[model samples]
Target: MPLGILEDNKLEHVPGTAPLNELGRLDLEIGQAIDRNILKHDSTGQIVLVPQPSDSPNDPYNWSRWKKELFTVVIAYGCGCVGAVGPLLTPAFVPLAEQFGVPLQRFTLGCNGSCIVAIAASSIFCNTLAVKIGKRPIYLATTLGLAVSCFWAAEVHSFGSLAGARTLQGFCMAPFEALIPASIADIWFVHERGFRAAIFNLGVLGGINLAGPIAGSVIQYGSYRIAMHGMGGAFVLMLLMVIFLMPESAYHRKGALNIDTGDKVIVTDKLSEASIEKSGVQEVKTSTTSIPSTEPPKSWTQELLPWSGYFDHVSFWRTLLRPFVVIASPVVMWATLLFTTCISWLVLISITLSQIFAAPPYNFSVSSVGATNVSSFVASLIGTLAAGPIIDGVVKMMSKRNRGIFEPEFRLPVMITYIVFTATGFFAWGESLYEQQPWPVPVIVCMGLINLGIQLGTSSVVTYVCDSHREQSAECFAIMNFIKNMFAFGLTFYVNDWILEQGVRNCFFVIGGITIGCALLTIPMYIWGKRARSFVFRYKLLDRVLKAP
Candidate 1:
């Protein structure tokens, strides 16, 4: 008997149940039919069993390009809001210091302290939460939590209150950073992944750049509280957009509910009709029976602690340790550290440049200095648009040359071009400071280059980490973010002091040298990366010992 037919007959015989409503029944029957006939394969038959194609309409990838773009945009914007708010709040330090009766230098610690906590908590919790409640819910909850934190921050009267709010906000916002990448992975195929990631990256950078000008305008007109309130409103709007527009991307098996009977119907048939038809088999109807779903629904506790049983899982520990392991691989470690250094340099430059341009011979007002971020905005947009397509193109070209086999290292060539451009910009900025060149020329040109370097370096390193450690990409990224932000937060505090002591020219010279040094490390890394990988693979002791028995 044909398995599909038999199962359908059994479904029909279930006592006290009416036929399913049109949509529900159609979906069920279609799914069942596809599973039985197309997905199932027979080994005994002369006929070859071809697997079912996932090109069906129900597949998320089969959705219209516009829908995919919309999804990308929403995820990008949500992550952007979460990422930008913390950094933007840095510029309001003066106001915060005055209001809270704290020293400006001491108050800066609040930003650093919050970032430290965020890094620690996110490394521990983001992946677990995403696995627990699913990405959609975590995303929604994080956005709501950030909004509440912002509101509390605005109303707080004490330094302790504001610091607590910022700390909690950091923790709340971590999930957005963690889950968006996973969501992108789930929704997009490999070919389109780079482009989507670029879009997400651009949104994050753009938000950071835009925050300066937005906050500047708000602070110009109103108090720090008002700025916080305004940001809170934006968060609320984002929350609404997410709830209504973002569909759950995680695969969920909803139990079939009988509309007429209000009881669950378990469909257990797993055979296809085409096999039976080809084998000249007869159709037999089996009696309908009720059975529970094959996989039981997870309990509330399980939902809360998705890593419970997995706590003792060796692979989980390995994943947690994988980033550190990769760090021991010289190429991976150097590339990641250089990437972290580049991020820290650019962030420090951005924060310090605002203070520099707004204060001295330039005498640009707070608003105008804030407006200087336009250079970063433009540079980020161009760099992001160009990086992915160019990297993909380079990979394709190299693969064709190598007889169609892809090597992960093909992505390294463009970094050379980026390094050169970055060095030129750094030299130019230093010379301008030394020569005291025109204000706009130095600020705009330097900012544009610095931003370009940041975009290229960040994108390349992230892609490299993913390629090298495909199974543990999340932990690698989490650790990378933690390190990058910690350095950046620390750098922020001392950058002004450095400029004050060393003079702007010497400061720029020092920073430019560091930038060049970081960029040059990439050349050796690209050359020795393979040897490093080989060494890691050969030495199983490090992997096994650190990962546990």
Candidate 2:
């Protein structure tokens, strides 16, 4: 019955409140065996962790390392497909318009409009359902549905028909937008999530940039329908992956662990001889859950269709509206604002780049126009490699320096990378384009700096938000995607006008100013982040609203 110092603080339950688990509590604690040993200091030689994991065999925290890694890949691929829809068919806009017998303008917003609305709106229903029912069913159903809708896109002959199909496709793809991050929280510890989240973000960027060339090539060589066919084919494959491998990640952690490791077996008196003597009328039972399965249960059926709560006493309608309530959390709101900056700039890049390359003396072809984005993708990779591993290391170091305490804002200092690269790139891109300098100037500046900045900024905001609110993570992510998409959609719709009004130089100067301001805002947040989190938790208003029926 030995207990450690850090363990004591974590297990102390607040009265009339949930236990201090990933979702219920937000605090630093001693690491489990692996987390403590994941890295070590040379000077003081102490162990550090963001939070410890529970020991329940069913807890995703206890899953084998390989299983977690495999799941991350599958989830990232799914996320990639969903994000690809945002710009997937942009390269084929003209051809699609001709085939649909509509104005190119109508086709321009055809899929993009419905896709944005669906992504923003569907997260409410999709994430809520995933939290209550489980992650597996939603993944399978949505992916298959998305696949079907993708194929439908290949055959559509009218703008109205295309929009209708895209709307459904968006709802199906919505899980990748929000729940994929939640799934990471379900399976990973806080120290492990930043790097893992960066992987998912990379996948998202891949989809956004890669889709342009893919669609353009298909249209250039074959037909626009071929592009949809290929996209649909990927979905079909992912749906199969989901069915065969993606199991339920939501674990029902019912009781508190009483041991130091939180990994020891719970002593059940009911199974003991003395308890059996007192209650001879019944068989032994454990309080871990209402339904218990055999030890190391082995079966493909169970793995594919884990846990049965198909008709659980939950409300889908309430879940649909939960994210709106969760948005009230200050951390969620701020993280979203930071996230929106990246999304707005991303839309600006997508929209304004086409305008620049299509109209200028350069007069780049559509294919070349689309291919230019490859630079951004390359920059994203550099940003990914730079931030992925180091972010976790920085967290471990900072947490250890602070006596093994971890705060959400410890992730904020990385914003310097965003400011330096993004600001320089923004200024260079604007000024170079305004002066109508050589193509190399804007391309090189954007690829090397601004894209790098966007990547880092994206990783910073998402990881911080996900880390700060693990308890309500699914709903919080829904809020992030919902609001961010709305802003992105609107930005794309109106940015041409914004650029026209302010001119390119003035336009990006303002964008650079906003980016710098967002980075500076992190300073106060880092200093007072804990107090702000405490302020939210002390009242527990978000919990009440989210859980309210």
Candidate 3:
């Protein structure tokens, strides 16, 4: 018998009637070897492994253009409703206070307290949950929950019930803040992320600011119950859009099956082939490989806790303790602090504007104060539209000059011009209030500039952090959100009291000074950002950089 011969569709030894001597055996082996060499084939053939493409049509990216746009719209709208609606409720403070037999300050606490909870919990849990269950479902669940809570709030008679409903609303809404960005990141590539994020940010800002007008209209034409009902309706529409149009972005979808044995293999769908090809464009075939687990798989309880892994990782604890480490990195710290201060100041202006317009000089009603938020909505739109492409262009230009190295600091140039405009706007606003200037002047100059500053500061800071800590952008952003909301929460509570005590003139002066100071800090950060990054990398303090989801 010769082992090399093919038989019955399988490789087999050739069988003869009898055993052979050494020379006979050698001859048979040679014959069999020749036959095997000429007729060789893989037992499984070519395997026909038509892997689901990375940018497969089935993937979120490869979805129809309408679908992507719809997803963007849904996310933006959902997030906008969550962020804006609650803050706008501030206008109803007096009524709420009277109804609950509580002080205005206590009413403010309900709103502000919810914001604090959102900031604290969102940063901790959003990324972890998105990584666990997935983004779309979380987005859907939270949005619907928010709507239900809104309805519950409308029906509540007691302060405790209202507060509890609002808290639940805030917690559910937290996912919108966290998941929208994650969703954007899932579908958009690095080059396109800025533009898409700009759209998302605009929705968030627009929705929040627009809430005033929307709420105002509801108050004037309808009851609080009516207003909440309308908000709930809007959320329901947003929910429907998500359920129908928002496909799972390829980044989150589980791996597809192996063609041969139908076993699953881990491979991320490629963005180009996955998203682009769905648009009827041709793309290259990509080889697939299994994804390696970087962190250990989590149990249900571990998954629920936002800071689960960190409890065990000493470095994580160290990282938590040294949030200022971001500040120490001239770029991260400076940008974060600058934007944080800028946002705080912008919020101050908004708070101040509301009081000024609604009180003595203007004598506008609560509804009017809420309606004035329309100015911010407009400014946010303009700022967001301008920011995306311009920021991307600046980064691209600088990256080219730097031999394709990208630094987060490239986004600062635009901030310079914005700061000037913002400062001028603040001064103009203060002067307008002092002189009791006509309505249009403050609206155009003061309100416009405040919002412009907000857009510039927010956009710049978000993009900077994402760029600075590529891997940990989600966590970094979570931390940034935590800091921002904490600042905002405190300011919202007291800015009114400050205005009452110091008078508008001193308050505006103080705000302007703070903004100018924060804007100045940008210079050192912009200058030293790259050098700082290099230093961090060299020292292997890169671990200190926030990791993305």
Using lDDT as the measure, which candidate wins? 2
Query: In candidate 1, which residue ranges exceed 4 Å CA deviation?
Result: 1-67, 131-134, 244-326, 329-331, 537-549
Reference-based lDDT, each prediction: 0.59, 0.68, 0.58
Candidate 3 regions exceeding 4 Å error are 1-67, 250-331, 346-354, 400-405, 539-549
Query: lDDT-based ranking, best first?
Result: 2, 1, 3
266-329: candidate 3 lDDT, tens digit per residue: 1123422242223242222233232322333333343333232222223444445334344445
TM-score between model 2 and native: 0.83
For residues 352-429, what per-residue lDDT tens digits would candidate 2 score against the true structure?
A: 655667676778766766676777778877878877776777766665555545556667778888889998888888
What is the C-alpha lDDT profile of model 1 across 1-549, one tens digit per residue?
111111123232221122211211232432332222222122332111111113234334444567677778787788678756766655555665776788766676675456545754665466654543456666677789889988998899888888888888888777665556656654554335556666666777777787777776677667667877877888998888777656555542122221111112223223222223222433222211112335444443443432223122444545455445545655457665776776666666665655577666776655666677788778888888887787666655554454333334556677775577676777788788667778777768887887776676666665555444443445455566666666766775677678778877788777778777777776666665544444554565235634465
Candidate 2 local lDDT, residue 247: 69
Give the Cα RMSD of candidate 3.
Answer: 17.0
Residue range with the least summed lDDT across 10 consecutive positions in model 3: 14-23
Model 2 misplacement above 4 A: 1-51, 94-105, 255-298, 306-314, 500-502
lDDT of 2 at 208: 80
